[model samples]
Target: MPQATKLSAPTAAPTPALPVRGQTDHLRLIAEMTREFTASHDYQTIAHSALERITRYIGAEAASLFLLTDNGETLACSACYGPVDITGLRISAKTGVVGRAVQTREGSMVRDVSEDADFGASVDAKTGFTTRSLLVAPLNIGQDCLGAIEIINRVDGDGLFEADDLVLLETLARAAALAINNYRLTEQIVQQERERHELELAAEIQRDLLPQPSSREFPIHGINIPARSVSGDFFDIMTLPDGRIWFNVGDVSGKGMNAALLMAKTSSLFRCLAKSAEHPGQLLNAINSELCETNSRGMFVTMVGGLFDPATGRLTLTNAGHEPPLHFDLRTERFTPIPADGPPLGIMPGIAGSDGYAVTEIDLAGGMLYVFTDGLTEATTFGGGMLGIDGARALIRDHAEESPDIRLKSISGAVKLPGQSLRDDLTLLVVEDMMTARAASMPPPRLEAMSTDGEILRLRVPARPDRLKLIRAAVEQAAKYCEATEAWTFDLTMAVDEACQNIIRHAYGNRPDAGDIVVDFIRRGDCMEVHLMDFAEPVDPSKVKSRDLSEVRPGGLGVHLIKSVCDEAQFVPPPPGIGNLFKLTKRLPSKLQ
Candidate 1:
């Protein structure tokens, strides 16, 4: 019967299905996607191309590609292709089926998503799309999971996503993962470059804002160093038209752009109001009020400002919640701390109250004044210790004899000597009550005559405040020899005393050891001329003018007396190696019949 069942045409053998066609297509899809991923370095472009390809190939209604946030706690949707744009959407990396894929570095298939325990329907609810099925695959390269690629609501009315789809999608996910990482790294480099450029520009602006050593006699110097490219610490030195100097040192609360901007505004205010305000306290009050009006960031500034008169050795100081200043006494070789006068600026409006900020006056004769921010005291060392206030005081006391510039450099070098980079800004301001670097470096003065006019009575004496009476007596005797009237004798004596006092106080910086002054009285036809020479610092020519007569002030009267009493008063170039030569001349009366 088996033989008879018949070969019956042997039933045409079924043709075996070709495996090459399907395999070739899958490989072609991978190759094409790889080319697209490498075409451009832009994150958005790569992400968009990947999402579009996956959504169309998988027959899905929507697909979203997410990358882990910088914090790695959440996933931010980078690209989307679907009924709704979810490019900026964010979701927790631990919340749903997507979380499972990223956590396990595997594939997830959810059919009838409503029935799945881990299926979060929030996205579906948000987009108003009814999701029937979803497939999520981890975008992983080695052990690092970049995030997940999710396809939702398949276009086909299939029962569920197949196992084959998961394997195919994971392969595509690997290529996309690398592209995402490259884009992210490139973006990070670009961001760093942009910040670097901004910092350089800010540094340049800050440099221009700082003061340079313009004065030939003023002994004030300051320096600012930033932890980053921009500094929050700032110091200002301005010479007023009335021969007084205004100086300040300040530290903003933080560092970088915000603090830098605040510092610029604060310093500008100090410069603008310095002329109109008479006292340091008044200037600070105006600055505080102005800063409070626009300081929405709640930042504060700790600062100290002073008005110094080189002519009188008087310094009026006003401190605003800053580190106490150190007054280094040249005679005692010690530092006395000057405490703060009020709270910091920008903390509250009307901080000065009804009377205004408190003012403190101190005589800086035979000493140096130092004001600095907290950075100098709070500089950290590798041993976890800080350069405290006591250490800073000792440093200043040790370098008391050096020039202000040299002393500041020494302090800064010691602060950063640990070789570690600074974590804060450093600022130092120094005003010495001694001859300036220029004067100290100059040789002794010698008498040199320009021309022979008449017989001269010359006298050389120590340039000291105590010897001023002797100078007046000598000048009076000379006036009598010239047959000057009694009234003229009194005016000439007073003028001589004022001139010597100016030399002793301003040019010599109130130093007792400053060189001697030479006074020569010459009687020419119809005129009497006196010449004064000293080996001291030259006075600033721009600061030689008289103050407004209407405005009342304690100092500036010396300049007024010299100009008012003499018919001609001027500064002349000193003999070679000398510091300064001042000339004063008065018209003599005609001989009576």
Candidate 2:
């Protein structure tokens, strides 16, 4: 419109070129600085060495490297090659010429400090040094500015920094920035690796603190699983000389390393104190007092501790702000929940009061007691739902008939999905009342001769399949002593073999360490009676039904075969200290009698 005033592109200012000698010297100096930076990994060492070389190359009387603090509000002099030794000096990030260079990500050349508004005279005043000229180059990588390098009082001709000096400083700043960045990244990687290794070691130590899995026939069993590299949940079982078992399940308030450390401390205290403490209440009181003395983080522990007498099927429990334990009755298939009675441990020295945590006495008559952390209840199921208390009860019922070891596995496996992270740490414990079950199932003792009266043969052997042959041999010899025919002896031997096989497989759950079996062959009057005894968990006779012979299967035939060969086979009341007593009777021929 207004004659379209001819627009012309403005010509860019030409970059200043260095003299031939000066260019060569700069290239050599850059090469030397690169080699020096590449050879060192220590931050302070590289910074100090580079600062000295840079001051000499730039022909400056003194130089300092300033790095931004983590908060970016202040600048710290990390290294210096100056007479004043300004290392560790601090200043506001926006107060000086060096700050401006870093903030603007550019280089500055001040011919006279008096003419510069950003120059701070305070440092010179404090150190008793006079500053007339200065140059600053920002240490930058891409869009990030780490800090700046400051050079003061040029020693060369004219004693003033020029455009070429600023350019050279900027080039040197880039190399230094790259070296610092690389060092920081490498340090981070090394720190992470070290932390990972330490965590693995800690996990191993934690595992060692837990008791080994108990025998399947034992009255108590427990399991623990961690959500991360470490767990905040723990369980322990220790049997006293009098057959009373001390057991506990605990959960810390938080997670990660802190929680794990607390769990370890609490568990160790329980094990160490429970040995002398007469009851669960007293034991928990002592543990609580100890924790309160050193629990500076305000963390607490929720736990359930119990003292169980297997002989009487009695459990005295103390709950410290933990989830209620479910007492499952085998006969009625119902759960009786025992709720917490006190605040969590570590809250206060006398949180439980003078009497300590209240005790709940329970009679687990032929049933089970289940104690667990909230993690099990909050676990995600395959259906994408949380396994609440009801779900946990269902899992228990489903695996109730299994051995304690197998039952724990089944219950935990249902919620521990593959490739999925758990929401929290999980732990579970079970206390079975085998004594009550044995008492209920045992029949009255018969008024027959004792085993010592007509003990034709008596032998004790480990409950293993390989040891069954010894029982067969002893039975055969006992039949001969009673003057029975070869046919009669063979039949008794086969029956005894089948009976012993049942004891090894069913009574002991085929475990190698499951106590032993004691057999007694007695010839009383006209009848020869054989008695077999085991110390395993009592077997319910009603559940030991013989399968139909018509069905073809690999197993479920031992009981049928034993009953077929004997005239009468039944379970009788065992003597004191015995779990089960099985008797087999056969009337000898008249001639032998």
Candidate 3:
């Protein structure tokens, strides 16, 4: 054996002096090596294959491949084919002959390691292998140093690396750089796909926690739109077992996955606690305490909650540092805000500086209560202008006369307009009182001849405030004729009086000259039914809201009283030619039955 000789020593010039046949043979071998580099995508496989190809081409005994880490501070040996296994080793990208090649973006050759200043003896010192001639090439792509490849002690031909070897190794390193970069890009794409799938699942779970819009008893409707894959805002409305409706809207402090998780927790706590809680304040107190204890992220919630009693037409509400709700007044055709009275949830437990959560009551005479998160008010227009409080009020007023369904659609459409970007989650809820509304929009009574078979009493009186006495008296007499109890008679009379007064005052707008108010007392199979009709201007159903009874109010208690006394009190829209038809049905006891 010729000592397994390599071609010349590393002291050779840039272009080696070689015979025509040898130079041609080197070119053919390099073409085959380039094909190997383009064939594989596995990083380790590519690095291992490059090391074997480069070492064999230069007739060297050992080789190693190092790649830069993501942080760019160090290079990690990804593969090795040498006397000692140095795989998985890490070093600074500023270290030995490999570092010099990477730093200068060129290749280097050392004829003798003992005489070379850049030779790092750490590898040889550990492996106890004597070093001699070697070649180093930087794995570079577009001026970026990915890493380097090194070939050690030549064992063939002249036992040294030549200038020709330098040229071949540098070319091979360029191809290896591309393969590494491709593998890195593929890993990044896979990671992003996994995160996207998780967000979608979170969005579904959040939507399931929401209460569906299917309550006709309260005529409640709303919509929620998220700025991202998940939302930080939510609205909930549930009719309690006791015929009372509880509704609330909340906004978390942030957006994305973290905010979505917090929103779900807040909403779940509300649904669980609101079932047994009596007042809006009590519900808020329990919810605030629960959230403060488990909330480690320090995120807070701004919320507005309300309880509506359809029987009494009373709405009790609590606002916890949230945007004020827009009150659409049908009488005045204006919008008023229900301001917040306490701080937001998770802002330090119980109401700050106050004894407890302050409850605000409103006797919805005939108006709509519109509640929403700040996302609606803070939304930006195409011109980059915010839809401030005033803008929100104006928008609600514009659709004040619309039905709940249309109103919700219009609001959602305005907030999520085409080509406009949403910066936060949006939520809106609307509650309306249609009884008072139907009374104000009375038409003339349709009097052809209702079956008089069970007619107990019938009276046609002038629609005047003074004649309310006659209406009540007639109702009391009819109750007595039907053998009704004292309690039944009193409640019927009072309920009849309220219905007539609401007609004379609100329906006719206190104009006695409007028309006659028809009062009919009919006895059905097992109940007493009274039908009253008044001719007046048709009222917008969305404008009627009962007055708040907690306050020392002088008037507006008539509708609340009638609804409380009558088992079934509803404003029947006049059929065709009829005015506002007010029907009050009360079940009679066995004696009257």
Minimum summed lDDT over a 10-residue window in model 3 is located at 1-10
In model 1, the Cα lDDT at residue 485 comes to 88
Each prediction's whole-model lDDT (CA): 0.78, 0.83, 0.76
- What would the per-residue lDDT of candidate 2 be over residues 141-259, giving only the tens digit for each residue? 88998889998877666768888888889988998888777778888988999988888887888898889999877889999988988999999999999889999999999988888
Q: Give candidate 2 misplaced runs (Cα > 4 Å).
A: 1-39, 436-593
Q: Give the TM-score of candidate 2.
A: 0.71
Stretches of candidate 1 exceeding 4 Å from the true structure: 1-41, 56-62, 67-76, 82-105, 110-134, 141-146, 152-162, 213-216, 296-298, 332-334, 380-390, 434-593
Mind giving the per-residue lDDT tens digits that candidate 1 earns over 1-593? 23222211223211222323366666777788777766776767767777777776766666889878867789989888765678989999888988888888898888678789998878766765566788999999878999999987655546356667677788889877877677678779989999999989988898788888544345678888788889999999998987789999999998899999899889999999998998999999999999989996789999999998766566899999999898875533567889987999988878867887899998764467888888888987445689899888877766654456667888887888554667688999887654333344334433333334553466678888888887787777777777778888888888888888888888888888678887878777778888777877667767867778899988878878888989988886443234677888898755682
Model 3: per-residue Cα lDDT over 1-593, one tens digit each: 12122223333212222323266666665666556655655656766766776666667777899878857778888898755568988877787888788778888999788888878888666666657888888888887888888888877567677787788777767766766676678778868988899999999999987877664434567788888879999989888887788999999998888899999999999999999898998899889889888887778999999998765556999999899987775534567789999888976777545567889999664567889988888888655699888878877767764567767778767767696658888899987765532443544434333453366766777888788887787887777777788899899899999888888878788875887787878787778889886656665434544578898879888878988889988775442223577788988767724
TM-score of each: 0.63, 0.71, 0.66
Runs of candidate 3 exceeding 4 Å displacement: 1-42, 45-62, 79-88, 123-133, 155-160, 215-218, 276-278, 294-298, 347-356, 381-384, 434-593
TM-score of 1: 0.63
